[model samples]
Target: MPRTAATPEQRAHIREQIRRAAVEVYDEKGMEGTSARAIAVKAGVSVGTLYSYYANLPELMRSLWAEPVAEEMVRLRATVEATPDPLRALRALLEGYANFAFDNPDILRGALLFVGRVQDTALAPAPAAVEFDQMLRDAILAGQKTGQIKPGPAAQIAHQLWAGVHGALALPINIESLDFGSPKQIVAEMIVTLMASVKA
Candidate 1:
């Protein structure tokens, strides 16, 4: 069971198991309440074995959040790339962004733990976050090129799209009582209204 000799698939599977355990423990017990021992027991591995896979709990936490986000980024990119229609791709990207949150609530919540605890990387860009940002920019660029999008700075439009969907996500969390309708529906209309302003 030499770690160095483990196949990529083997390593990925083990890492996934560790991450799932960490996520469950983290959700039930706040980050401070979670420990290497708890994660190890939950994962059915020895504490020493867990450390062999991850240097510490914090590292595991980062991986738990980062890995899923990266995977979702791949999904989002594929979904966008598959659609040739610019407007359709834009819609796909927006829904994909919201779906990222919906699909991985635990990992996202676990990541919030690092906000203040690890200042350097906490606020820093995760690779998946970066990729998602790129997809938004790419989608905007594609729309602009096809004349489906209004003429405006691609980056600005991308940022606006990002912020708008992000707001959609936040409203549901912060004000659960208010019926926002479906996030996608609200965002789809936002997309149309925004695109109208920028259309050539």
Candidate 2:
């Protein structure tokens, strides 16, 4: 007898299973060692089956992170927009970003690895990354207009804010030997310093 085709639900389940396996392999082997065959073996599927779901390992990794990052950006944007004070809105945005990174360390790590590997000049910025940058720029611009933040190029200020906060969060993750104390407190202090530098 011919086998029945997989239902949508079953297909989704299988896809998720493959993603979980990929994450596990990534954790164990890092980006340099992870491969389609390893993930397929971990997922209990053939390489052909894995290819059918994802064109390649990079595509599989992108699928894992793209939606979560986009959703978080939307939530952060709403948080920023709700605040009447521009300075507070910027604070809220940075805090929200810190919270997301802390809450989803594995996803964050996976995303960083995926991005580092795929940094080709020909590739366009990911939609979520572009949205995140624009959100920061918008907050910075609003603050500058109101004399809450110092006058400067909005894009430059946005980059400073993003880079500073991201460095604070990424340091402990990359250098575990150092005593960085609480990441939350570190980020809060970093925010304060960054805001002070840009304050009008």
Candidate 3:
């Protein structure tokens, strides 16, 4: 039976505890092997309790991983927002992107895998993706208006830049022996190349 909580504070605490336990289990078991019963035992709750908070295993995992991804996205958006200059803003964005992936490789990998699998089937996007798209689009449009970026459709330029940045980061991370000097260095170079491509 699920533990009954008398207060909102207690319920919130139990929910956090369950989430923490789920993250630990995910670390060991990966998503496929992790189960609600397993998470319940680790969390000291009933499987039904887990279900009460999260409708299903996928939803739970989504919430679990979304925390880190959302955090990184916030940092990325803030970094971009802090610098009004187009070029400097782009550099800061690139660095934040590289740093997050480097610092949280496990979370990054899990997110990438989950996103790849469910992206086609899932109609609703996690909030981070939406924020990222908006920010990047705005940035590109701003750059074009400032004459820092070459004349092109802001939408196409934003899409290309976004894809390029991820490809630049994703490549060396996936291939250990690919031998980029460092993730930051490669990302910096990639940013330069991308900036040049877009520069007026």
Candidate 4:
């Protein structure tokens, strides 16, 4: 007799298993070295089974980040919204992002930082990422309105701040031999410097 198909819960469980296995494989070997077969082996599932859930390795890799990014955005939105002072809110958002990245280095390197070898626009910024950018833009606009932040395009300022903070957090992780000092301290100092530069 033929076996019954997997239930919705079973499918979700299998998808998560595949995603976790992908993260491990991704950690062991960078994106260029990873393959469906390798992930399937790590997941203890057939290559065909892995393909059923994810269209390709990049898709699986993208899945690894989906939840973490969304969750982080939610937390940031809450933190920004709660702080009344716009300048304080912007500082809080930046610091909160640093803390999250430090806390989840695996996810950071494996998903957030890793741009796949292929140049696919489908892999463009997620909705959560867009939301994150909007959050920064909004915070900057508020601060500028209050004359706490320097006058400039809020979106550009937001992008610059994000780029600076991300570079600081990513450098130590990407280069193990470099004695970059504590990531937390580096990020804190970087945030202060960036904020000060943009101060009115």
Candidate 5:
């Protein structure tokens, strides 16, 4: 007899289970400690079945790590476009990003840890990473044209601002022992500082 076809919902369910399982394992036992077999067991699927969904561990990690950020990036792009005011648009965009990072602290931590030591081969350019930077660069350029921001290289300024966000968010997530303010507060303050510093 031919195998019964799996419905789209069933496939989605299984994929979600696998992703959640990976997250749990990665959380409990850092990325290095977790394996595909562990994730399969946690997901209640055979190793073969897990492989059917993801070719390997990195593929699964990539999906779990990058998918949400990509979605956020799309939303941010739309939100910024909707508001023609560059200052308000940029504020909203940065705030949205900080909220995302704050909400998904564990995932952000995992991503930072995983990327730091690993070679470039481990990560593809995140769509959000590229798109967010581009949007930021454009915002800076706009501000410059309006004489609201200093005239300089938009790319470099964008990089500095982006780095400030990532660096501030990363410390709280990575070093659990270190005392720090909430991620939201840090990000908000960082956003203000960065914008103020760039003002003409």
Candidate 6:
């Protein structure tokens, strides 16, 4: 039988336990291979208990996946917001992006695979994708307005930059040879090249 939602403290305990067990299973078997029954057993709960909290496997996986990305996004947004200089802000954003991917390589790979599979199937953007694209657009506009970047359509520039970064990151995961350099080194070079295109 499923465990019912409990008091706040009980809820916290259950959620934390589930998260740890989920990560372990995911790490060992990858997201697709990790099953609710296995996760429940690891968490000392019934599969029904897992369903009580999460509607399905994808829902649970999405929640788990969002945690790290959401945290990184918050940190990146705060860093960008706090920086007064446009060029420095862009650099910080790129640095944060690279660090997030490098530090959480497994999660990053899972997310990329999931995103690639689901992206065009829906017309509406996923929450993370929308927020990420918006952040890039905002940064580009800010740079242009501050005269740190040359005048151009902000949307066009944002798309170009996003495409460049996505392709760079994706290649490393897809092709072994391309994974040779540290992501930081590659991102730094990409940032420099991107910035040069926009310099006033």
The model with the greatest TM-score is: 4
Highest lDDT against the true fold, candidate: 4
Please list the C-alpha lDDT of all candidates, in the order they appear: 0.72, 0.84, 0.76, 0.85, 0.79, 0.73
For model 2, the run of ten residues with the poorest summed lDDT: 113-122
* Structure candidate 6, residue pairs in collision: none
> Candidate 4: where are CA atoms >4 Å away?
1-14, 27-32, 41-52, 119-121
Tens-digit lDDT track of model 3 for 1-200: 99665598888998899999988888888756677888899999998988788766666777877878888887887788789997778667656766777787776666654432233334366687777777767777788889887887877887788777788877876677867777777777888898888888
| Ranking of candidates on TM-score, top first | 4, 2, 5, 3, 6, 1
Residue-level lDDT of model 4, residues 21-55, one tens digit each, is 88788878876668888899999999999979976
TM-score of each: 0.63, 0.78, 0.71, 0.82, 0.73, 0.67
Clashes of 6: 0
TM-score of 3: 0.71
lDDT, residue 12, candidate 1: 80
The local distance difference test score of model 1 is 0.72
In model 1, the runs with Cα more than 4 Å from the true position are 1-25, 30-60, 111-114, 119-123, 176-198
- Scanning candidate 6 in windows of ten residues, the lowest lDDT window is 114-123
| Per-residue C-alpha lDDT of model 6 across residues 10-101, encoded as one tens digit per residue | 87789778878887888887756688888899999888878777666655666777867888888888998899787787767766776777
Each prediction's RMSD over C-alphas, in Å, is 5.4, 3.8, 4.0, 3.1, 4.2, 4.5
| Model 3 clashing residue pairs (backbone) | none
Model 1: per-residue lDDT, tens digit, 1-200?
A: 76577788987887778888987887788756688888889988888988788765667777766656777778877888799888788778877766666666665456632433432333445576677778777877888888888777878887887787776666665577988888667756765665566556
Clashes of 4: 0
In model 1, the Cα lDDT at residue 89 comes to 82
RMSD (CA, angstroms), candidate 5:
4.2
